[model samples]
Every structure is written in structure tokens, then in C-alpha cells.
Target: MRRVRYYQYGGPEVLTVEDVDPPAPQAGQVLLRVEAVGVNFVDTRFRRGPGSGSIFERPLPGRPTGDVVGTITRVGPGGDARLIGRRVAALAEDAYADYAVAEAQWLAPVPENLGAGDASMLAMSAPVALRVLRSAPLRPGDTVLIHAAAGGVGHLAVQLAKLLGAGTVIGTARSARRLDFVRSVGADVAIDYSEPDWPDRVRAAAPGGVDVVLDAVGGPVLQASLDLLAPFGRAVVYGAATGKLEHVPVVSLFALRSVTGFNLTAWRRANPDEARREMDELTDLFAAGRLRATVHAGLPLTEAATAHQLIESRSHTGRVLLLPGGLGPGAA
Candidate 1:
């Protein structure tokens, strides 16, 4: 088996592809033949270490741990044989390999028509967006605001909010060019966050104030999101893309408003059932042609360093994928 591993925390150069014997699944686990691996911001963060979002607490046993989607090939003790040969997506670590182990419960069936790359996208972002929206208690007629609305999680979140009956969905992007794509994805209005008074513009677009706010660009953005929320509204803080530190005002909760933090990794651990449920919904949407993934670029597994560079550069749009078979000259 071949897997990408990095023993030290650094740049993309740290990731190396090496041949190793594939490990057999232990009890209650299933072996999956890798199809497509999802490259997330956290994956890059973990690879680069302390500079990016709390990379491993102290010293992880080894570097490189993230999500993947693959097909089941073998079932271990306490695992159901029915899972063998099933196409599924799972939130497992060390997915940038040809094979990985997954607990059956965490695996969600992939739709027959969907390809590996698409399944890989849904494996992480969709589930997280669904969980965050649901946790914020979105209801019909509620106005929702999402920051970084053109990125991986943001784009899907725009559509998910619409499907959940959210009204006047507003998204912010630093680039005006991406606003068109954001609106096409179901956001009723799109704003360029580069503007000085973007939050005020969001309020202007949504007269009643946003009912729920999903913000990944934290720091001052989090504070602005709180100001944009309606009375009794909830603000879900998922990521801190700004790299700016923040001190939350606990006293603000008295205004019948609430602020909560949600990480997909932590949420998945706490609510597997909820995660699976949302995944199922996402699959249905994909199959029905209601959900689409925006892939910025695809590089060969061996060229993982290039993918990391594109993501870190922030010049790319949507999620970047890795094809284990390697890339052609025309490959992005």
C-alpha cells in the first residue's frame, strides 16, 4: 500500500509518498480501497504545524491525519459482511493513501451515480454545514448570513440553507468575481467583504437583521456577526480564517442572543447519527442534481505538495482534490 506521510511539521514539501504494508482492519473496523481523498484546510494546518490552527496538541504520534472516502474491500471481526464491496464515505484519518480503516457506523453510503471526488467533498464540508445550520436551529423564513461564502464549506452551506427554508440567504466573499457564483448557488444576496462597511451592507440587504449567522472568518468578523444578528438570534462560529485573535463579550448573551463554536471533527465525535443523517440528505441532493461540488483543481497524489500550495495561496476557488493515479500534463 502507498500512503502520504510527514513526520515533521512544515510546508507541503514535508508530505512524502512511501510504500508500506497495508494494515488489516481490527475488530469493528472495515478496510476500504481508497478512491478519492479530500484535502481540507485543517489538513494543511496539521501538516504545517503551529502556524496553522492548533496543529496537533503537543506531538502527534505521526504527522498527516485527515478525511477520505473509499470502497469497502474487507470486513474485520465485529464488522458486518454486508459492508464489504459497498461504496461509502467516512471521516477517517490518513486518507491520502490507497487504503484506510473505518468504523462501520461512521460510513455513509455513496450514491451510485456520484464519483469518488464528489463523495470526498461531501464527506466533510456538507456534514459540517448541515450540523452547524441545524445547531443554529434554522427555520422557515429565517434569514441566514455566512462568511467566506465562496469557499468549500461556504458554497455548499448556501444551498443547504436554502433547502432548509432559510429566506434571504446572504454570503460574503472578498472577491467580487466570486459573488456571481455565490448567488447562483442559492444565496439571495452576496457582498464583497473587502468593503469597509460590509457588515452594515449585510444589514442593509437584510432589513430585519440576520436570524442566524455562520461565520468562519473570526476575530472582528465574529464581533460584526454578533452585531448583525437579530434579537434572540444564534451565531455559529466554525473557523478563524482571519488569523486574528478575539475576546468574546459574554455579556452580550443577555440580549437574547447566543454565540457557539462548532468544529466538524468535534461535532462528528459527539453526534454520529446526526452526521449520517445530514450525509444522507446531501447524497439525495447530489443524486437529484440539486447539489454540486466546486473543485478548484485536481493534482496527483504524489504531487500533494502542489495542492497544498494552491490552498495556502488562497488563489484557488472551491475544494482541491488528489488523484492517486497521478496527473497528466493537462492536469490542474
Candidate 2:
């Protein structure tokens, strides 16, 4: 089996492709003949360096990209035999390889309407979007603002917010192209956050400010998101892609506004059953044609470095994927 690994953390240049023996499924796990792998910003973060108390706690060379979709080839002891040969999406570690082991509990059957690339993309982003929307105090006709709305999770969040009855769905991206893509994904309005007056534009669009703000971009954007909230509005902080340190100000507590941080990894760790339920809901949405994942690009597993570069550049819209098993070039 072939896999991508990094001996050191720095840039995309550190990624290397190598052939090695495939891993076998352990107890309560299943071995997947990986068809598609979802590349996310977190993979790049892990590649750069270890953050405090994060999964990347060390600088050890290893494979990244955990979101995977494929057919089950083997089931370990205590795993359901029926899973063999079934197409499923799973949250697995080291999924950049041709074959990866996933815990059976994290696996969900891929719907007939979903392709391998979309399924792989949905494995992580959809569930996180669903959970975040569900956690917020949302009401019909409410105004919602989503940061990084053209990226993997934000795109899904836009559609889910509308489906859940948000009256005004506002998305922010760095460029017109990204904002246009965000609008196409069900955002009622899309604005370029790169402008110094982007928050002012959001306020003008929403009138009395937004009722809910989903922020993945931190730093000054986090503070701006907090300021854009209406009275009693809620802000959910999921990621700090800006690489800027942020702290909630005491003044943000006025007007009954609240800032809450959501970490999907921590949520999954704390609530496995809830996580599975969210995944099922996302799958149902895809099956019903109410939701779809936008696949920006698909490359060979060996081109993991290229995928990372694209993501880091923020030039690609939607999810970027990697096809294992030598499925390269024209896969997209």
C-alpha cells in the first residue's frame, strides 16, 4: 500500500509518498479499500506543527487526512460481517493511504445518491455543520452569518442554515469568486471579508445585525463576528484559520450576546452517539437531494502535497479530495 507521510513539519514540500504494507483492521474496526480521502485545513495544521493539547502533540512523521470513503474489505472481530463490501464513509486516522482502518462505530453507509468524493467530504464537514446548527438557538426567519463560507464546513453550513429555516443566510469569503460560490450554495448574501468594511456590509445587509454567527476565521474576524450579532445573538467559534490569537472581551457580554467555541473533534470524543445521529441526518439530507458536497478537485494520493498547497492557498472552493489505489489525474 502507498501512503503520504512527512518527516518534519513545515510546508507542503515535506510531504513524501512511500509504499508500505497495508494495515489490518483491529477489533471492532474495519479495513477499507480507500476510494476517496477528504483533505481539510486541519491536515495542513497537523503538518505544520503540534498545537497545545491537539491530536498533533508531537513532530512524529505520519499520514494525515482522516475523512475517508470506500468499500469495506475486511471486518475485525466483533464487527458486523454485513459491513464487508459495503460502501461507507468514515472518520479514520491516516486515511491518506490506499487502505485505512476505521472503527465500525464511526462508519456510515453511503447513500446511493452520493459519490465516493462527496461521501468522503461529508464524513467530517456535514456532521460538524449539523451539530453546530443544532446547538445554536436558531429560529425561523433569523439572520445568520457564516465565515469562511466557501470552504468545506462553511459551504455545508450555508445550506443547512437555509434548510433549517434561516431567513437571511450571509456568507463571507476573501474574494468575489469565493463569495459567488458561497452564494450558489444557498447563502442569501455573500460578501468579501477582505474589505476593511466587510462587517459594515454585513450589518447593512442584515439591518439590525445577524442573529447567529458561525465563525471559523478568528483574530479580528472573531471580534467582528461578535460585534455583528443582534441582541441576544449567539456566535459559534469553530476554527482560527487566521492564525491570530483571540480572547473574548468583557464588553461582548453586554446585550446578552454569547460566544461559544465548538471543536468537532472534542464533540465527537464526548458524544459518539450524538455524532452518529448527526452523520445519519446528513446522509439522509444527501439522499433526499436537499444537500450536496461540492468537490473542488480530486488528485492522486501521491499528490497530497499539491492538495495541501491548494488548500493553503485558499484558492479552491469546496472540498479537495485525494483518490487512493492509483486513481489519479482524471479522477476529478
Candidate 3:
């Protein structure tokens, strides 16, 4: 088996690919032949250090923490052998390998309409967007704003908001190149956040004010989103992409507005049933052609460092997939 592991954490250069012997699956776990792996900012944060307060106090000895989409090849005791030959997307023990073990319950059946690349990308963001939309209580005719509207979760959140009946969707991009792409994903209004008064543009485009706000950037942008919300609007903060946390003003809620933060990790732990339910809904949407998976780039597994560099650049438009078997974009 081959895998990418960071002997020590610092930068992309810390990640190195190496060949190793495959390990046996544990109870309730399935060993999957890797197809595609999702490269996420959370993975980067974890790769950086313990400053982000990840669950793993110490790096898993030698393994990297990630997830993948693969076919079931073997099962352990109490696992479903019938799952063999199943095409599944899983959150694995260490997905950066050719064969990784995943708890049976953490795997989702892949839809025929979606391919391995898209399925792998959705392993994280799709469920996240669904959960955030549910938390926003998205309703018909409600105007909404999404920060970092071109990033993974933001892109999915935009489409999910539109599908859930948001009357108008506004998106913000720090660069001009991303503006059109943001609008193409169902954003009625796209603003240039690179400018100081971008929020003013959001207000101009949405008129009265936005009814719901999904923020991935958490610096001045989060505060600006709160200011753009209409009375009785809900603001949900999901990520701190800016790498800085901001203090919220409680008095702002007096205008019938509310502010809350959502961490998918906590949500998944608390409501596994509902989480699975939402993933099913997203799968159905994908099958119906109502939602599309945005894949910006795919790199060979041995080039894990390159994948990390691309993600850290913050220039890609979609999820980055890693090919564990040195497969290219054409891989199944």
C-alpha cells in the first residue's frame, strides 16, 4: 500500500509519499480500495498543527486524517460482507492510502449519476451545506448572502439555498475572476469584497436586506454580513477561513436578528441520523440533476504536497481530489 504522511507538521513540503504494507481492518470497519480523496482546508489546518484544537491531540502516530470514495474490498467482524463490490463514499481512518478502513456507518452509497471524483468531493462539503441550510431555516422568497461564495462549502451552500427556495442569493468574491462563477452558481448578486464597501453593493442588489447569511470567511466579512441582514434574519457562521475569529455584538440581535456558529464536527456527533438523512437528500438531488459537483482540480496521490499547495493558495474554484493509485482525472 502507498500513502502520504507528514512526519512533522509545518507546510506542504512536510507531506511525503511512501510505500507501506496494508493493515487489517478493525471491528465494524471496512477496508476500501481508494478511488478519490478529498483535500479540505480543515485537513490543511490539521496538517499545520494543534493550534486549531483538532480531536487528535497527537498526530495519529503516522497517518493523515482524511476521507475518500472507494469500493469495498474486505470487511471485518460485525461488518456487512454483502457490502462487498459496493461503490461507497467513506470517512476513513486514514484515507491517504491505497486501502483505508472506514466504519460501516460512515459510508454512503454512491449514486449512479455521480462519478468517483464528484462523490469524493461531496464526502465533506455537500453534507455541510445541507446542515447549514437546515440551520438557516431557509424558506421561500428569503434573500440570502454567502461569504467566500466561490469556495467549497460556499458554492454548495449557494445552490442548496436556491434549491431550498431562497428568493435571491448574493455572493461575494475577493477577486474579479470569481464574480461570474459565483453568479453562475445561482447567486442573484455577486459583490467584489476586495473593495472596502462591498457590503454596500450587497445591500444595493438585495434592496431591503438579506434574510439569511452563510459566512465562511470570519473577519470583517462576518461583521459585514450581520449588518446586511434584514429584521428577523438569521446569520450562520460555519468557517473561519480568514484564520481570525471575531467578536459578535449581542445588541445587534435587538433588531430581530440572530447570530450563531455551526461546526459540522459537533453537528455530526450530535445528530448522526439527521446527518445521514441530509446526505441522502443531497444524493437524491445529484441524481435528479438538480445539483452539480464542482471539481477544480485532481492530482496524483504521490503529489499530495502539490494538492496541499493548491488548496492553500485559495485560488481553486472547487474541491481538490487526490488519486491514491496515481490515477488521473479520467479515473473512475
- In candidate 3, position 148 carries an lDDT of 81
Top model by lDDT, which number?
2
Cα RMSD to the true fold for all candidates: 2.8, 2.2, 2.3
Q: Estimate every model's Cα lDDT from 0 to 1.
A: 0.78, 0.84, 0.79
lDDT of 3: 0.79
Compared with the true structure, model 1 gives a TM-score of 0.90
User: What is the lDDT for 111 in model 1?
Assistant: 80
Q: Which portions of model 1 miss their true places by more than 4 Å?
A: 53-62, 242-245, 265-271, 326-332
lDDT of 2 by residue, 201-280 (tens): 99899889889998877889998888889998998887777666587997887978988778877888999788878888
Q: What does the lDDT read for residue 61 in candidate 1?
A: 31
Better of 1 and 2 by TM-score: 2
TM-scores of the models, in the order given: 0.90, 0.94, 0.92
Reference-based lDDT, residue 316, model 1: 61
Question: Which is better, 2 or 3, measured by lDDT?
Answer: 2
lDDT of 1 by residue, 288-323 (tens): 878777777777778788988887776666677776
Q: For residues 1-332, what per-residue lDDT tens digits would candidate 3 score against the true structure?
A: 89788778688888877888877788988888988888777677777776644432356444666658888999998777899999888776567888888888768888765776558645677888878877987889998888888877778888988888889888887667678889888888899887988988987887798899888778888888888889999999888766668889888788899987788778889998888788788888877878876777778888888888887887777677788766554343
